[model samples]
Target: MANSPQPPLDALYQEALATFDTLLSQARGEGDPEPTAMTLASVEGARVSARIVLLKGVDARGFRFFTNYRSSKGEQLAAHPQAALCFHWKTLRNGVQVRVEGRVATLEAAESDEYFATRPRASQIGAWASAQSQTLADRAEFEARIDEFERRFECVPVPRPPHWGGFVLAPDRIEFWYGADFRLHERQCYERDADGAWSRRMLYP
Candidate 1:
């Protein structure tokens, strides 16, 4: 008798991608707004912070999102250069959870600019006006800043702000979890090694 052949790591990754696409599509069709929202966690030394961010892109490379470079999360990533992300869909009956852990890097300027161009004009101006994660004197002051930027870009295309751009999290570990009865859930994890090879394993639940 011969032993069973194991599936390649890349195959498992593709399967995970397919599953994500299917779930996302279903969520959208079921009228679940903000399906792309995810929780991003960052750390610097002993302190850690987590926030909700919208996912901008996903592919074999990793997950992508944009933020103000001067924000707290941005500062944390700069100091640590690694992070984790969690995506949960509770609207579904069984529910699904995805976890990703990886190193982070800033996206190229051109790529960021292209994505920025797709944002609504008001949002583009808001991106320019905001001093994210910083103390604001009052709502009036922030609105004034928005007004200023609005006047400055009148009848012109708003360019991506220098401090606003995207970050790509190149995942080293990715896990998918499915809710089960009696809390006996299922989990599948894929990890990349130093040699750039991937390995897949099942996690006890």
Candidate 2:
């Protein structure tokens, strides 16, 4: 099929971002918990893994989320650096979803630190306590570590772990799906060309 008539590149790019933010705001207005939650999928060798991760930020650069760099997903991202994200707002009528596919990059340390500083004190401690994606023998042992960090940073501020930070998925493709009657849904996809221009097209439901 012929390509959809293109809009000015910059406006189209901003339109996609604006639409995402609007959907997100509507979800929150509907009283949904974790409106920023998204399914993050990464790969390891011949295996694929997916898990729910909170969306920490998003912009033209792509979606951002934080995790322990030493975790399994982290290692996989380090090896692959390509991932997909799906944001499904079930609270929306019949549910709407946005899909993003992109290459990932670890954010600068300063950016990570800035976000870490805003987290709750307990979470800050947990960052230093939990060995994310690591095998745990028991709950008590993990609690013990948490207690240990609590006391260690009792008076001092808990700093972000060196192994914990943010990663941004710079999308080359993003699709939005709006559920409709009789399963005849509406799908719009915006793709970024090699020259960094964006073109949007509709996909058959």
Candidate 3:
């Protein structure tokens, strides 16, 4: 097979970012929303568990997601304090994979309160009802709890769960990948040195 042309790391990064921005627009217009859902992977004693989660925010600081502070992923991230996030958009044949390693901290009470306020009433009630990652006797029992919470909080705004909050992943490494014709692919990686500066590099496909 012949080697296909590949975009330079910088160019590819810009292209992927542009495509991602367009995708974001489509989601907003359609009111479908970007899955922003990423596969979060955590390592524990050479074992790893991964699950999808909705991303709350992302920027130079890092990506943010909220969940129960005591959930399985939350506990693993707390103990290991490092994880990976992958965003793949099959509809566009594009994906962004980020590797983040940093300490995790629960969001401040004020921040959690503000975010919770923006959630739908049902979501707010569900948060209060669900134990998140804990076992329940049966589906009916869980539904009953949800109904109870709905009744209890009726006409009153649901408060943020004491155990619910968000975490920011300060990425030490960020990798962006793009698909191309044939099997040729483009990869660009950014590494943050001890001095807290980002350096970019290209990788073989």
lDDT, candidates in the order shown: 0.89, 0.93, 0.73
The TM-score measured for candidate 2 stands at 0.93
Error of 1 at 102 (Å): 0.5
TM-score, candidate 1, is 0.92
* TM-scores for every predicted model: 0.92, 0.93, 0.80
Q: How far is 80's C-alpha from truth in model 1 (Å)? A: 1.1
lDDT of 2 by residue, 70-120 (tens): 999999999999999999998998889999998999999999999999999
**lDDT computed for candidate 1:** 0.89
> Regarding lDDT, does 1 or 2 come out ahead?
2
What would you estimate as the lDDT of candidate 2? Answer: 0.93
Over the stretch 58-150, how does candidate 1's per-residue lDDT look in tens digits?
A: 887789999999999988998899999998887765777889899999999999999999999999999999999999999999999999999
Q: Which candidate tops lDDT?
A: 2
Backbone atom clashes (below 3 Å) for every candidate: 0, 0, 0
Candidate 3 residue 189 Cα shift, in angstroms, is 0.6
